[model samples]
Target: MIFVTIGSIFPFDRMIRAMDDWASAEGRGEEVFAQIGDGSFEPRHMRWVRRLDRGAYAEAMASSRLIVAHAGVGSVVTAGELGKPIVVMPRRAALGEHTSDHQVETVSWLRGKPGLVVADGEADLPECIAAAAAAANAGARLATTADTGLIERLRHFIHG
Candidate 1:
């Protein structure tokens, strides 16, 4: 079971489409599932789940061997905490889901991090998916830039 969730805020239709195509071609007959918010994504081979509760979401993450998602820090942190290898794709601002092109920067930062693979475009997604599909293959790595220290500091500021 290959579980994928694209947070409603991200532009992930392209990535979803590519994954669906690959799943069919590879003939692995894998079950690809996701949540389609904004009613934009037309789920094909991948089953479009209408919604998932928090427990369901966490369970899904736990069950998944490969977690592909947008370059959101929350998702990255959760996946990392669970020790799941994640393939992150940034949502481009030009595509109109974001206020600016910050996700590209986020993806870049994550790409440099260990235990993370950033899939920035459609062309890059299939390979990343394949690499992850291979058991215990972490794929190409650049550097590990994820840090929880900043998050802790931010929490202190918020609570202060």
Candidate 2:
């Protein structure tokens, strides 16, 4: 299964459609699930999650073989924390999917990092999925992450 998320901000039809195409060519029994706005559009291959519990999202994230996303910071941070292998495709401004092109910059940094894989588009999802599956199978270790003085530093900066 491939889990596709565009975060909670805006619609990302391009990423959605790309995953839909990937679902068709990848495997017969494979699943592609996406989170979109209003949830009206439908492609033959993929599934859309219109309204589901956060638990459902968490379950899918934990269980899915490959996690495909639109380069949102929270999602990327969570994936990194979970040590989940991710394939991120940035949301383009011209696509009318986001307020700014920060995702483009964000994905640019994330793609080269460990435990994350960045895909070009839906056309690349299948191959990316295979690579992700191989990585998952390989049992590679992700980085150890932590924030030691985040709150204290923030408070000091604010107060000072």
Candidate 3:
């Protein structure tokens, strides 16, 4: 199963639509479930919801074979902790998908990280998904070292 998420703060119809189209065309027999935020593009090829509750979100992530998500820190962190194969497609501000290009910066920093495939745009998504699927089949797991460091930093920042 491929679990797709775009977080909850913003609508990311571009990513959702791309994934839906890719899944329909690829016919790889993988089930896709998406948490699409408040996006307007309705997925035709995969199961999707506008938003998921915390428990449902956790359950989806835990059960997913691969995670296709926007390059949000929260999503990345959750995927990292779950040790899932993740393909990140950053939302572009120029396309009105985000408020800024922070997701682009995030993906740049995270590209080549273990268990991650960064898709620069919709065109790269299918290839990245294929890569993620291959990695998952090969038993690849993301190292949580970076996540641990991030947690520590957050803890200090919050508690200090």
TM-score of each: 0.78, 0.80, 0.88
Candidate 2: which stretches are off by over 4 Å? 144-160
lDDT of 2 by residue, 1-160 (tens): 7777877767777777777877776666887777765544666788887545789888878777668887887777767667788878887777676778888888776665666777766677777777777786787534556445776788899998
Over 1-160, each residue of candidate 1 has an lDDT whose tens digit, in order, gives 6667777564467767777776677626677677655546676677767567889889988888778787777778877777677778887878775788877988876664656777878778777776655533644332244357987888899998
Q: lDDT at 135 for candidate 3? A: 87
TM-score: the better of candidates 1 and 3: 3
Best by TM-score: 3
State the displacement of the C-alpha of residue 135, model 2, in Å, after optimal TM-score superposition: 1.9
Q: Which pairs clash (backbone N, Cα, C closer than 3 Å) in model 2?
A: none
Clashes of each: 5, 0, 0
Q: lDDT score, residue 64, model 3?
A: 94
**Candidate 1 pairs with clashing backbones:** 112-143, 113-143, 113-144, 113-145, 114-144
Residue-pair clashes, model 3:
0
